[model samples]
Target chain A: MTAPAAVLDSPLRELSYAEAIRDALAIALAEDERVVLMGEDIGVYGGAFQVSGDLVHRFGEERVIDTPISELGGAGMAVGAALTGLRPIYEFQFSDFATLAMEQIVNQAAKLRFMLGGAVSVPLVMRFPAGSGTGAAAQHSQSLEAWFGHVPGLKVVQAATPYDAKGLLLAALDDPDPVMLFEHKLLYKTKGPVPEGRYTVPIGKAEVCRTGSNVTIVATAIMVHRALEAAEVLAQEGIDAEVIDLRTVRPMDRETVVASVAKTSRLVVAYEGVRTLGIGAEVSASIVESEAFDYLDAPIVRLGGAEAPIPYNPELEKAAVPQVADILSAVRGVVRGTR
Target chain B: MSISSETERCGAQAPAPGRKGSGGSARPASRRAGKTSAGNEPFAVRHYSPEVLREALRKMLLIRRFEEGAEDSYMRGLIHGTMHLSIGQEASAVGACLELTDQDKITSTHRGHGHCIAKGADVGRMFAEFFGKESGYCRGRGGSMHIADVDKGNLGANGIVGGGIPIAVGAALSAKRLKTGTVVTSFFGDGAVNEGSFHESLNMAAIWKLPVIFICENNHYGMSTSVERSTAVRQVSDRAAAYSMPGVTVDGNDLSAVAEACHGAIERARAGEGPSLIESVTYRWRGHSKSDRNRYRSKDEIDAWIARDPIRRFAGLLSEHGILSEEGFARMETEVAEQIAAAIAFAKESPDPDTAALTRDVYTTQTESVG
Candidate 1:
């Protein structure tokens, strides 16, 4: 029998982003009885994507409730439990399924606080494995963070690394407003250091994964990791590329991005969401709106998924979302003729 | 109660016409005291206990006072948002809630002040909610439509029409699975029965045998459309037969009858009897919200239903039972008036929530957060 993975390792131990998220949830549930997980096939089935693998055995069905295939129902149930003082961590089988529960998330959960004259809150965290990489096609693959980010009463976050996946989820579970945590399906296998003990990565705070003086590259979810890879390739070409992981999309850490752009003097925003009105557009506009635009060495570049439905074909799906090569090209183009 | 010249209210006394009964009887004029322009009438009465009778009267009066006060504040522009008043259908809320233990939970609708009060929420906090003050149950984050006092087992007053049904089903599932012996009662309107959530939740609850009581307050209209126009079966209770649950129609205006029906269902549920459906035939005295000037019904219909006022009927029963004399009933009314007056004063005097609190409780901090 394979023994369970070690938990006492240093915070930097290599682990898949999905494992890291599971670790974070385990630590959270172990620490508090109020924290419970609810979603379709999250328990006995070990999650459709296995993000909640082995949780049912550890927490039991009570803590890790396996619900019916009712997205709106599950979302509404989460809102109810949250309002009743339970910290509910709800999971959407896929980000695309979130559309079915939009009324609960957007109308009921999101607007509850504001409409109630700011009297009550929905202390709920909903995790949706988002973005296109797996040939899950249009219904299952869509980076719809912009849809949730546009809602005023909801906090939206996306995790690119094993570290942020674990930490941001922990943070989202703590927030009183409904929080939508977008996890890139492809990033699950990627490992990074995740602290063993309970800790939270603050929401709405951007992480500067790699520092450079040439160009500020702001990216979200899987795009953050791709940007980091592009930054590494850019470094070899004598082009210093700074990568900003937009861990939280709503109540975005604009200050961090603006400060980075002020130092780097060039900005490139990237995301897996569609190009039009996506997180990329929001970040680019923020840069132009801020005092940092005066220091821009070139026009702020925005790179995002093609403005089309995610295709079923593998090659088309790969081309739809920004890849390392695309980021590298975009960054190299921005840094060109600057010197 | 005496009307004061200082207060200018929206509704004026008008004789309602064409108010037909479920069985096609001519509506009584006295029952139409304050029916909104929608010619809806109060349903027939059920059995009443002496104590239950008084309790229902008090609660309904409380709702009436609360709504009257809310409308006053709303007209004055002191209340910021829209207020949905359950002025005429208090018996349904109180009667159903009476069957619930403190452990049992209720999911309310957008027009939910009556549900909150019946579920035992503090009147002061409810008032503070409308005032958008910090003392409100949600600390000003949740207003009237979202008031939730978990301690009182009121899940919340939902803003979306059919939103709370699923939550109640989940809570019922939790209760049954956890063996908590706590049933969940979901209060929605006839309008909500048409929602996809209503059907989905009912099917899930039935299949799971989750302990839930789906109380549809068929108050004759969903916003403006009459139940007759929307539903082929005039009696909303008939839908319960579709889910294979015992469907019973109760006089929502008669407090005792509602309590008896709910008590049987609640007891059966606690004993693992699965779920039941109770369609409370009722009417609304006010418009859907404070802003509505209901033009759907005639003056005769409005005047007719007011005559069958639940509060007045319950008071009459108490007098007939010799539980309380006319003077004693008057004293109860006076006490309720004073209590409500104090609640209003308390809300008026309560401090507003600090602006910084707007960001707090959105997430539980490690130092201050939940998880």
Candidate 2:
């Protein structure tokens, strides 16, 4: 059930997660005439995070459309375009803005194909800059990947690294169904080696970011980066924590996740979203419902964001989601039987 | 709030109460602003050749017979799932799509069978879809509310009221960007115009000058709630002013009038003048769904609208003009009835979907990396 590591041979470039996403968009735009970008302030404004810098000039305003400040309308247009012939990549200023366009995303884009008896496919990509730590407060900072993953037709993924941010975006664009790509706001500036040119990391395969034996920590979005950092700290403490970066939340690679859990009996699900009914719950259930259940040596634990809105206060924002120290301690507790 | 607006006193094809057309008394002093004098005229359909009018009549009749057939089948329990038939609003559906080429796209509402038929969908597959047959357009996946033919440029009908508005705008955006010369027609109902999606889509389309025609089939009800109960504006087209687009209200039962208004709007879109909103005020003779009894509406109200049946009115026009003889009209009606009958037979004989289909079409197991 294990997939080969998606190691690209193209020229390696150190790019931030935001830069990798922009590059992937540029590649998709250049390679195909059907692809177009639409979002608020993404064109001349260089995006909220400057992710799509100068794309307006390069692709022109036609292909790189600067839509009116209407998320619902823009998302609906993207669905319509996807329903017709063109492939549209829509961007939400923040993941929270998606709430305004929930009807379009949930009812229209997600259900069009199935509702139409599979007569058409909505080959649409929606980019959501999600997660917290920027002190954007309750309205701005939120992880709603689980909300979209809960839908039957949507392909929900959390791009953890620059390589994945680029590769997953391309993969999502290529996917025949609607794909919700959630990029953590904090990871925009985090740099990693990303391959150049046309390449994609298949959706639904969880990659083992840091392979270990004592415990398995399934992390999503920014938590994967945090889990990797926590793994380094746990390595020094003699606890080898296997970190599985759950790239895609839905159509979950249960086989890969179960295999990791079977390999490492102790399991810890880490996510920045709220713990209740989150991706962590799904991951926890995946192992509990399978043969991996009998292999569990201890009660599987979950370390996720607290059941509270992300506060504007920096300290509270840091406390909201599981930080490296929290992930490190959670794994330590599960591994050393400290409870 | 009263469900009736000042202009809600008449049926789709009826002349405004106490108001006349071009030859009648001068336009009302208190007449709702922004509506054109030309939009109130029913003779616009005569501007086209008799041939075009005959085809428009044929299209409307086809929708009428098709829905009647569907209704019969539904009653017989041959159709599994429920459907929203455009029984009384045939003119709006036909006229909106009357002039559209195969390259142009359309998105319909839950009451979309007429839209699909107008867009050249094969009735056999459409009936098959309603019967949940393997041969249906959606292969039994999308039933009545979900029938779509991408090849015919029908983007499929939406279950949500204002759902198709944005999609039509998107198709227009695609057309504008690709220089495809493809205009998109969006067909919704009175209830949909109030939806936030309508406002957002109109604003975007107006600003971008996307080739989109927004046809609001104002059937006087969003389920059971009337326009006065739902909207602040008297005419659904009045909302268009907020988005800087041209808006009009036309008699939806008059196919020629609906066709003429849509023709202007479609041409305006193709010419890159931006989107236009046309409120084709019509009525649904039937209930909202299979379960909906006529509790909210009075029997008199239903009878009044039914008297202005779009197909019957169009047939009268064609007959009056000598474009279609009485015999020809009867023959067309009989042919459509036979077509529906054949479709039902095809659906009844078709096999149920295999178990493997359960796991199929769900973007199954893609391991290949995109290059």
Candidate 3:
């Protein structure tokens, strides 16, 4: 597969990664009356990160509501709106702050439809800016995608590029169940070629960013970029390692994973969340429990953050999360096998 | 601590049942007249007409009976989940809910049967929920604590102590944004007033002027801890002033008083005056939950609050006004009993949810395949 030949032919503009999100929001709101952006400080304050810059001014306050610092209240309100025939795109100021609203997300909004016996659908999207940066410390910096993926009813997506951000967001709005979109705080300034017109990427499919045969490196969120960098380093050593972005974590792209395992016979799962019960666990367990187990010549390797709480100190925080160097070493170890 | 203070005659000295001086040893109507005349004049109360009063009485009795029946089932080992009975505090739920329009919404507490009946949930479906049948409001997945019907404006009963407060405020926020003209009433016990969500929600509602009524049913105890011990301020309503909103305390045992207080707050909220808090002073006749032994209180105290029983008091007023005779009371009881029995029968006959449906409503995916 030669990568679908860049379906978007428009000249790529030099927009910040955050501008791409705003552009995506502008397009969605301009195209559909049902789409609305809601969050704390997103309106008059242009979002805490300014991702929704000028959206309230552009779409008016009715469409872009600046909510109080009540995550649970705002999330529940979004759930109510979504239930009442509206597509509500909710923003948590920071992903770490999402813990305050867990009751609404995990208990009510996530389970309402299923509890109602298929009679209702919560067509809602909750976007949380995740990962460590800007010295936000323990309460703000967390790669918590695994916590949401652990849930049964929610679809969790982490888009690495600007194109995936726009496409994944649109797809999330189109999804009937609640979709959790984890946007990395560090990736907001990075930009890429995003389609100008409306386009959607299927939610539960994984994109193999690079193809190789020596080893399979699966990563998510910021770790996807790190894995890509590691893939280049491994290739320089004549070790062709395949890199797969497990974009959607809940209904995981197991077929792509199994296929990669069959080709390489070595697997390395990387994530930024804690090591235990993280996406790595799910990916590793899936391979062992499936037909892919027979094709694996070596044991599957898993790499993730430490189990301790995210530290405020910059050095400890860096040590807690996986880096490009970590990915390179993990990939090499998997390729070299038990030695 | 003399009982002869001018405020004492106005029912202000009516200690919670089973508390100190809670026995009905106080002098009769003679003392009540003197107390009520001096201190009660300032607190405006709306009186219901004889016919209207009788109907409200009927509703309260229905809630009491329904809960008692649920307790019976729980004791017999028929119900799978824990049951929280609103036995003593029926008037607060029934009285306040009666003031709401059909389109008005409410978020309920764990002890929610009273709110469900007052908000017009189908008794059969409520019974079905207790029975764990597929025909229940939540299709058996929500059991008791999560029974919800969006159509009926009953958002749902929550299991968390102050969980429903934020949700109800959210619904009110939606109503304000959508111009739905629907005001939400969030019912929680006095204990929930101490929760951070309670303050957060009230502050938000006040700032936005959202159409919501925060109804705190001060049933004296929050699962065995008295409100006085848990809170420094005497009444939960006083906290409303912190948000710059009006606060009122009403006699929860009086159905007319509760209805009027809630009615005023709802009207003000709909008029865009923002949210208000109404602290209804009531008692929970039963323990916090079905399994609680209620060793914290005395028998005499329970007997004291029983003297101010909402249903009986309202019924007495109705009879005194010639609105209901002995025959009418008998007829109402018979009708209530028959209705409850029919609901039980309907729930029993209703089939259990298919085992395959266990994974059905978990998500909105088109894949009919099971997880």
Q: How do the predictions measure up, each by TM-score?
A: 0.84, 0.92, 0.90
Ranking by TM-score: 2, 3, 1
- Give the CAPRI class of candidate 2: medium
lDDT of each: 0.77, 0.81, 0.79
lDDT of 1 by residue, B1-371 (tens): 42121122111222122222222111133122233232332211234445665666677788888888888988888799787888888878998898677789999998899999999887888888888888888877778888877777887888888999988886776676557778899999999988878877777677668788889988888988988788777576667767777667666676655665677677767878778777777788888886677888766776666665767655554554465676776777798889888998889999988876565644333222211
After best superposition, candidate 1 residue A251: deviation in angstroms? 3.9
Q: Number of the top candidate by DockQ?
A: 2
Position B258, candidate 3: lDDT: 67
- Residue-level lDDT for A226 in candidate 2: 82
- Each candidate's DockQ: 0.25, 0.50, 0.46
Better of 1 and 2 by lDDT: 2
Better of 1 and 3 by TM-score: 3
lDDT of 2 by residue, A1-339 (tens): 211344455558899999999999999989999999999999999999998898998999888888888999899999988877798999999999999999999998887766665666889999999989888999999998899988877889998989889889998988889999999999999999887777788888889988989999999888887888888888888888898998998778788889998999989999988899888889989899999999999888888889999999999889888888888778878888898
Which ranges in model 3 have alpha carbons more than 4 Å from their true place?
Answer: A1-14, A31-36, A80-86, A116-120, A311-316, B1-54, B366-371
Q: How well is candidate 2 docked (DockQ)?
A: 0.50
For chain B alone, what TM-score does every candidate structure achieve against the true structure? Answer: 0.85, 0.88, 0.87
The fraction of correct interface contacts reproduced by each prediction comes to 0.35, 0.67, 0.43
Q: Mind sharing the TM-score for model 2?
A: 0.92
Q: Which predicted model would earn the best TM-score?
A: 2
